[model samples]
Target: MSFGPPPSLYTQSSVAADQRRRKRRRTVLLCAVAAVVAPALAVGAWLWWPGTASDDAKPTAAPAQHRLDVRETVERRPASTQGVMAVRLSTDDLPPGEAHEMPGLWATDKILAKGINRTLVGVAIGTDAGLGEEAWKLRLGGPICGKTRHVTVENRTAVLFRDSADKESLCNHVAFVDLDDGKLVWQAEFPVSGYVDKPDAGSQWDPGVTLTHATVTVTWGDGTDAYDMDRGKLRWRVTSREDCISQGAGGGRALAVRFRCYDADDPQSRSTFEIRALDPRTGRSRWTYTPAVGVKDVRIISTTPTVLATSAGDVGITEIISLDARGKYRTTIPLQGGAYVAECTDEITYLATEECPSLAVGAGQVFLTSKEQGDLIHNANWIIGFDLKTGHSVKKFESGPNTLLRPLRMSGDRLLALRESSDRISPMALVSLNPRTGAETPYFYFSLPQEGELFSTTEFADTVVQNGRLFFGAKEAQGPADADSKAWVWLAFGIESAAAKKP
Candidate 1:
């Protein structure tokens, strides 16, 4: 399914006609609502909102706590690369495969693997599959550049690459291969010229990924494309004026995408932002909303076929907008500074900002962090909580200066914040934060070999939290002062709640 702008700009007469048509539709919908409201209002007026209190209202029990356990950890490295790098995880434990080397190396570039432990897909300058010396490599028809921006796993069957084939044109291609055996299943290419940028321009950003039951949606900057994973064929293409920024799958068998279109005259300024929800199977527009343009830090919070959008105003004013079934403005709620929202349940929303602010339909409570005045410093770190619905600060906690906190995952009542020293020269530490109480408890701190000296250029890879354990990989290289560094090592750590305190 595809969508595009009108063939040409609308004339004055056309604009007036569209307005009249929309206005008439609104009138009919309003009349239909009024006709049914008289009888429904009597029963609804007496029913209290789920979270509110009433004389007959009774509190529901909290959900049962699930224990998180670390099952296993296996380290895999590519051949030729000195660093034991590129670790992919799957649900089942698999043997450590031989490391494969790609053609290019960039600080921001990454290798993706499908599944938990098994090597389902791999891509670099060319492509390869399987494990160890038994792995097979396939040479693409053309010289595969290492500068590919976004590579995604599709339907556990194929890999998609945003390839820059020429100086003026950007092309998207997919390589479908068998997951068990390294065999080419199929390949398709789409050429795009308008949004293409020079290699040095860096306008090509991360592409969006949305996988439906039947098709996988791959949205590039100014164009949207879908692939029938089962058949390995192109479904449709939708081109737009702006770069598609984000996308999400809603419950009502619909897919939503957001994009920003800038005014051509003022290239530095954006003129409009649009959110469109489409039927995933047919590629038909179900609803569209074009909000005011001043929302500088717009981010898509959630999207459902019935409930289309949730977004923040900007970094400073944390106001969230929610759209209704008709693609019309529904409600707006103020959020706290640095508030982060995540989809917790199908019907409820969870937020974990500085501290942790949460809300739900039947029951909800706010968790906050606290600190002392002496803890304040120019670069000091702290975490706080606020009420998501009310925008009120609930609590605050001090984490000390030069401390970096990365959220691994949240499970049950525990919100794990991986704490490490900002000073790359020092050892790393892990800290756990409780979302319910705003308490930060240091879990484990480990030191690397001081003589080797930490590689300042290498970043401590972000940690992943699953089940109940935190996983992280660290890279270190060593060499003579004047010579190029050759010695490299990648270390994986599995962290769990400590049963006994260390002396």
Candidate 2:
């Protein structure tokens, strides 16, 4: 959840998902597949990308098609990292040479990212999302300034962002934006001052929002506020408790909230965590759920239309719990270990494991990747899909088995898997599967140039999949961090043409 913090920053493990899926697969077929697939993927890596001399030692087998096309090359370091140079080309069909360039001012500054209508705002590093609709090359007006965290998309038409460049994380201002172009619909400041500082982690908590089908709710500091999305006017505001400070909140559900109330004076006093659901209209308490004894500071893992997913534990163990909208316990999915994987990613909250996904909630189900609790990556396998109604296993699939095959996206009907390089030695691939039947189909694949290495973990953001495309950012190194210096490359892969079988 901290993503540990990438000013140019943001980070998944899939191991957990593998074990959960393996438990249900009592069959020898899946067991055998798990035993063999990973090395096979690694063995196959050299075929996709050219590598150092070692790769050359092996004979090359020509593949049917090249996975990706280099439309344009990014400039370098600061320019490439800032959101300005990000949207150089929109996905929409464009002229042969029209490309976007960054304003020199943003080279060292940070850029926030948010995805909408398959298009990205602030950061459009490359057109991997697609290359036909008209590329989204939006430039931020000089008015909005912030170390750029992310834009909270309220709807297809508008987005909200905290525009304070102050690293203190205070909310001096917020910008309501139009998706058609990078135009500010409205920019306003919170009536009060300071956004609480999570100084221990070197991060700030600004107002977080929740949007329902009709209303908008935001969590600023210790309280909640409601706004009219169309007019940008405050409808209601709830001041936080005098003794309790609000630590975190979540949105993107049904305009509902599960706010964290902590000791205002000490902030770190997590001995007790109070989760309350607030009325989106009046900011009044609708319901509150308190953790049972032994489990302190129950934190939200994710929220869905049918359930509120959470994690809590006593010492070093963490357990996943699900509650209905009314805050009634549905069931519990127990997990081992602590310290969820932190990522410098946008739009994801739960931490994943080394081999499986950390967690996914959608389509009336909950998903989790187990930690490397017992075995390491090469041996761990399974991904569990749990019923949101009973918190029981709905289905299990032999996730990556020997491979780091991760569920990158979970929609209402299907799950998309992206196979990535683990040691940076394997070639990355993508596939899609039916959560119900476990049917697999090759979606796409790409190779890193043999000359470069994957970026440092801190600069890496998880892959974003939408509109038949995959968008990923990586920091490349010619040497070490101080060596040839650091540069970034954003990869966009169009998967529409090869969703059925490998080309």
Candidate 3:
């Protein structure tokens, strides 16, 4: 989606250029200072001390203090759920054309970064009483094909995009971007053999990327490559075998690959799936786990805990499998009989192998949302937690009628849930769910714009919480279904407050 900034905001390109110029000036000044001090430092002299003063007489500079951002302070003193709109981005800002798929959402202390159509954009996260403005934009050469939901501790992430704008172009380019300043730190292209025109064709698979603390992994159907996150240098490569095709990879605390193999000579033989864990640095196999004969598809829920979602005869996910750190089977939570909702795929497109947005695995529990229960007038769901060891339901958090709760991610040890807006009346909320008691503590509550109805359901949207705010955005931005009808579509929005001060 092409987004135009509001009247109150500056264009991202201009702001980014100005920031770059200032950074260059600072670099030059620092270099000049070092040059001036070079000769004095070679004399074995204490430059800052008085004549003949001993080395021990020199005073040591104090260490820099660490300052907390707005988001950090909010965590210390829980932000009021009663929040006002901080920023609202709408698709209506630009002329409507073909629908665009938006994929990635991330936040830093001062800005919220998102992948919109082909461009990565950042907007200021305004205070409780103001609206955030556009900060910067980094335009990729082509639409983003895949991205890593994992952000490094220093706030860096990776993205995969095509070499050109042509729809049939191969998604061969991978890059690491600095989320803080919207800068492309490094980018490199990989050899890809496939067809973007036919993603379902046997030749098409890769086009995926994932991140660990030190490595950025990218897969393009036929092979997988790992790169140094800082320098974009290739660390290792794994190619597909004649019988087993490399699907893709997932990474966070650990790295794993999904593969499919079949007997080419036996036409009636069934194809099998395998999950293989790899050493993030060297691409060496750590262990491999094979599912039941009938399991058709497998997805990674968490690499640290080694949790997976698998599908059998049906199209939807059938089981949630949890494995130990050593890849041993620990438990299987069944989803049959419509008892739970852990969908890994949608009608339009397949999510990344590890991008099960609604499901969370942490704190010795695999948390999932129960299927919505109620009639048209009222509907609700439960955030159910299943023990990773026993596969038994242990904790549950319920929502009120007309309200739905979905797990976003784990915050420290607590699971964070999004309390979706209800019937256009009750405002949406961000709540912290206690892992032990299933009790909730509100982080904040805020409503979206009328054009933001698309965010009501996060199934197809990306939701991220950082600092102390919640950012919810649409994955698909399109015009009204009917060409003749007119409807304002919102691209994304943010909720935050400066009013919640430390008590």
RMSD of each: 22.7, 16.0, 15.2
lDDT of 1 by residue, 287-397 (tens): 778776566534443343122223344323345555665677755555444444322212111010111112211112233222222322223344454444444555444
lDDT of 2 by residue, 335-354 (tens): 54432331212222111111
Taking all chains together, the TM-score of candidate 3 against the true structure is 0.79
Compared with the true structure, model 2 gives a TM-score of 0.59
Cα lDDT computed for each candidate against the true fold: 0.36, 0.39, 0.67
Pitting candidate 1 against candidate 2, the one with the higher lDDT is 2
Q: Candidate 3 at 295: error in angstroms?
A: 0.8
User: If candidate 2 were superposed on the true structure by all CA atoms, what would the RMSD be?
Assistant: 16.0
Q: Local error of candidate 2 at 365, Å?
A: 2.2
lDDT tens digits, residues 325-380, model 3?
A: 88999888998666898866352333388888779987789999998888644778
Error of 2 at 26 (Å): 54
Worst 10 residues of 1 by lDDT: 1-10
